[model samples]
Target chain A: MIQSFKMALKSIAGNKLRSFLTMLGIIIGVMALVILVSLVSGATGSVTDSIFSLGSNLLTVTISDDKGAPINLQTLNEWMEKDGIGLIAPSGETSATARYEGNSGSVTVYGTTPPYETINGLSLLLGRFIKSSDVDNHTNVAVINETAATELIGYTDCIGEEVSLDGVKFTVVGLLEDDEKSLTAVFGRGSVVAYIPYTSLMRLSSEATSNITSFSVSAETDMATAEAAVTSLLMERFDQDDDAFTVSSRDMLEDAMSDVTSVLMILLGSIAGISLIVGGIGIMNIMLVTVTERTREIGIRKAIGAGRGVILQQFLLESVVLCMFGCAIGVFLSWAVLRIISVVVSSLSISFSLEWNVVLIAVGFCFLIGIVFGLYPANKAAKMEPVEALRYGG
Target chain B: MIDLKNVSRVYQVGSGKVYALNKATLHIDAGEFVSIVGPSGSGKSTLMNIIGCLDIADSGTYLLDGIPIEDYTETELAKIRNRKIGFVFQSFNLIDKLTAEENVELPLIYRGVGKAERKARVAEVLERVGLTKWSHHLPTELSGGQQQRVAIARAIVTKPSLILGDEPTGNLDSKTTGEIMEIFRELHEQGNTIMLITHDQEIAEQASRIIHIRDGVLSEVSI
Candidate 1:
């Protein structure tokens, strides 16, 4: 076996250009496999991380049809006092043009009560979130994230600064810390955003209503019980019509996201796998050519007492070694490509690293391809009659 | 020792049957240097192929050192060729990629010899063939005579019972041919059995006993 391996290496080394050309298909195949799979996994990982960062025990409620029985801040507060409910924050959103010292931009204004901060896991960089008194007094105070602070107010420490929303003045009480890795940061492109008291938003924008159509709730205990409780409450409020509202927990959303991404990963991986099969065919083609070219060598070896098994072993080893070489180069190139991608997307904070499982799959797949593709040509060479082979080109 | 009785090899040519080797019988004792001479299409190669265990006869009972050659499987025949026969071809047939020493070690490698023993045997044969200094050179780097010497060393490295030379000096110049023939004479003196097949009268004349083949029939000629 060792002798066969040595001979295989010698033969491969003897024809450097042809060997490298033959391996190119395998190299490209492996690169595609590793890079595509790793990118999907890396993106999925960051997305999942951001999802979990939103708070795993949180449930979101959206009312498509209130059915003449709408939820309000008072009702949400009452629900917060019930079992399985930790905090309830009723929210509504309206886009408005905001101005600060004549510099104006369109900003999305989220109307929510004090419990919104805890439920959404929002962290403050300065001042404080909306207070319970602020909601009751209908105080025109706003909280802005880092993007809003930088884009509209020029800095993050803009607390106590008043900004006009559609010509109505509101004091900035808090500056929310920016999460570049958040799904919003990835998809929303850091747009100007603000959070104000729900009552204040109702007074400022005609589009804002007293009815709370959307709200988020953090579970005090298990999420399933909290979800069931909220569902029952919504069902009772809507005359037992479940279609009036929808209650979905963070865990369910996370599972759905992963399922979609995993399916995407498999689809991408198989596409790359097709390229690997093409690469294997390329190997088989070259190996067949090599066998024909070295027919005399086979005859010589056979005449000197080499059996069919030895000849088969030598040719098979040659192809396998060629594929493995291609795989090694492909893996290295994938790493470099991923490094480049990571550098390019560093602002999004999505680091694309080579996943070990994907690498293992690439390697294992390449080995299988080697054996599967190499067998035919090797068998052909092995089965040649010594005299007929010798007589070839004599 | 070798034995053959009524050995014949047939070939299908279109719709006609052609006899590559006719029903013929021959014998030679151990340590004999014998030669078979014939023209291009007179079955000299067929005779050599059968004797070298490369091709099976259609009808024959041939024995090599008391073992029946016809009863053996393909793998067993390969073993017989590896253990009992050494073939020197007209074109030298050294693998182009391997070094001279590596080429000489081929038979020993197939025989499953240990690396150390193979190396020692290879070196000994290279020294015997007077090509020790060229052992590290590839066949492409060596001269025609040197490559033929490497092939000869490879053949003798396993101490095979029969050294079958099928026009071994056919590609060499006259001087190199004379040198190769001298080596064969020395090997025969050392009690090694040798068989030389050639169409050249001068080359066959050098062997101790010569056999003539015309139209696939063989007749012994005492030299």
Candidate 2:
């Protein structure tokens, strides 16, 4: 084996350019694998982050009938207690034009109770969010988001300022921070948000007054179990009407997106893997030529009593050496290229991530390709009759 | 010792059977030197190949040092060849990439000799060919005479029972041929069994015995 290894090295060294050309396929194959797998991982990572951020441990309950019962706080508390859930935030939204100091523009007002901040992850940039007192008292105080405060009032710190929705005047109690970036991070693409008390909004004479569309719930443990419990509770409550309420969680959506990303990566990676086949074919092609060129050498060795196994090993080892050399070069080249690409795409938040597992798999794949493709030609050389091979000529 | 009884080798040439060897038979005891001479296509090489175990006869028994040739596997034949026979081609056939000593060590390597022993034997054979100083040079760096000396060194490094030379000086001029033949004659004088095949009558005449092959038939010639 050692002797065969030495001969293989010598043979490759003897034909430097041909050996390099044979390695090109492996280089391309591994490079493609690293870059494509990294991109897919990055994309899936971003998607999972957004979905997980939305509500990794939370479940959403919604009923289209809006019987004013499924979304009520009493009903939410009942389900929360039954399921050992910790928080519930009832949420509703409306697009309305607002005016302040002669500045007028549209604002999306999310009406919810006091638990919205903790449950829905709405943090305040200034002042305070809507409290339970404000909801119970039906106070006309509002929590305008960063966009609404700036666009409508021309003031980032607009607490205690008066703003009119249509014809109703209300005091801005809090300025909600902009969640536009986080939203884009979740959905891969965002706008702005505003908040007000659900009770105060119901006083605006909406036809669905006191009716609820959706409420978000959170449990302290075991999301799968919590989600199932919540879904079944909602289903049983809506026994009067089937398919009226829908309960959903982020994990299911995450799994779906994960599957999508996996299939996508495999498809793209397979396309890239084709280059490995092409590379293997190149190695085989060059190896066959090398066998023919070294026919007389094979003859001499055989005549000197080198066995068929030795000749096969020598040729097989040559191809393996070439492929593995190519793999090393490919890995280094792609790592360098990915470094440069990451630097260039830094502003775009797109990373070409090369993981160790991907590299190991690529290297292993390259070796298998070498053995598979190298076998036939090596066998051809090994099986040659000594006299016939020695007599072979131009 | 070498023995052949009715050994026949046939070649298919353009859909016709050409008798490269036709019931040819010969024998040589240990420590004897003989030469086989013939014109082109007269089966002289076919005979040498069979004797050297590089080729097998189609329909006869060949006993080399008491081992039946045709009945053994290629692997077994290779082992027998490695231990009992050495080959010297007219073209030298030294792998040019290897140094002189490395070429001489080839058969010993196949024989699984230890590195220390291989080094000693290779150095001894290079000295025997009067090429101790040229052991480190590649085949291309050596002159034709020196290269043939390396080939002869390679042939004798294993100290095999039989040394077969095929037109051992065919590629050399008269002076180089004389130098290479001098090495073979020395080995023959040292009690080594040697069989040299040459078409030149002058080359064949130096052997103690000469065998002629004409139309694939062999006969002894009185020296």
What's each prediction's clash count?
A: 0, 1
- Candidate 2: C-alpha lDDT: 0.83
Q: What is the interface RMSD of each candidate, in Å?
A: 0.8, 1.5
Candidate 1 clashes between residue pairs 3 or more apart in a chain or in different chains: none
Q: What's model 2's lDDT at B113? A: 93
> Candidate 2 — which residues are off by over 4 angstroms?
A49-56, A62-85, A92-111, A122-126, A132-183, A186-212, A220-229, A236-242, A347-352, B14-16
lDDT of 1 at A194: 95
Query: Model 1 over residues A195-245: C-alpha lDDT tens digits?
Result: 999999999887668888899988889888889889989988999998888
- The deviation in Å at residue B37 for candidate 2 is 1.3
Q: Per-residue lDDT for B1-223 in model 1, tens only? A: 8898899999999999988889879998999999999999899999999999999999978889998898988778889999999999999999988899998888888889999998888989999999889989999999988988888898898889999999999999999999999999999999999999999999999889999998788999975
Q: State how far residue A10 of model 1 sits from its true place (Å).
A: 1.9
Write candidate 2's Cα lDDT for A1-394 as tens digits. Answer: 6777787888788878888888988999888988788777876776676676675667777777744444566666566577557677787777677888778777666778887788767678899988888888889998877767777788797889998886788898888776643635344322445677888777753723565778887776777777767777766667656478877788777778989988998897898789998999999999999889888888888888888887888888998989999999999988898888879767546556677788998899999999999999999999999988888771
Every candidate's lDDT: 0.91, 0.83
